[model samples]
Target: AQILQLLRDLVSERDTALILITHDLGVVAGMCERVNVMYAGMFMETGSADALFARPRHPYTLGLLQSVPRLDAGRRQELQPIPGAPRNMLSPPTECPFAPRCRFEVEESRQAVPPLEELESGHHVRCFNPVPAEEWQRTRVGAA
Candidate 1:
């Protein structure tokens, strides 16, 4: 493990950028400085991996985080799953894309797409009525 860490450190000492595509958020948390979160060919958020994980602004990013089990979390704590299935690429959407199954979607969301806006600094969300962080917490507790 020490040898492997040394090799990783040596690689990071270079100017080369390594793009790792994986569902392993733990790996990203440990080794990555930046993160690009994407869904349905659209970017949900992009920024420092640590900052994003610490206080996720996008509902999608929150969902992704919720789905990952944490060693620090209690054993009785059940990880939340990402809601809804992926849209069929064969039959693309015409609205906010995620409106169909999004809990925070409004009528307008189903009729029009919303641009990704910078909520704060590097955090951005492509939602007109994103679920509030408080509401998300309630929903998780209720579901559990």
Candidate 2:
């Protein structure tokens, strides 16, 4: 991808910062030491790629990961995309904007919008009812 090449060039040039905004997680995984996953004009999660992708704490983040397809050790592969389009960001919005598409959304989620919280050291997510690790694992199992 062009972005990847650019990032490589930037690193080669010893740039201090090269801010890139993109939807490609593969690019993040490849070139970024850290990443911030944003949605509807807000960051849902921000942390090192190793920590965030290795263990996503937010439902929105989990959903984003689930949307991407990965190769299995014993199988051939095709990329899987996230189900549903991103939420429309009108000039103004209310409540948990991603609720409509988030399977984990609950009654409490509808009551208020949550700001980012520090779920773990250096890992932040913007959901009041963050998914526990086991539940996230179960979701992947069910999807499998």
lDDT of each: 0.72, 0.74
Tens digits of per-residue lDDT, candidate 1, 1-144, equal: 485476577777985666778788767776677888887788767778866776665667777877877666688988778778878867656887666656667888888777888777876778787657675564432234
| Candidate 2 residue 91 C-alpha distance from true site, Å | 4.1
lDDT of 1 at 9: 77
- In model 2, pairs of residues that clash are none
RMSD of each: 3.9, 3.5
Residue range with the least summed lDDT across 10 consecutive positions in model 2: 71-80
Candidate 2 lDDT tens digits, 66-100: 76765542256544455577666765456777777
- The runs of at least 3 residues in candidate 1 whose Cα sits more than 4 Å from the true structure, single-residue gaps closed, are 1-7, 131-144
Off by over 4 Å in 2: 1-6, 73-85, 138-144
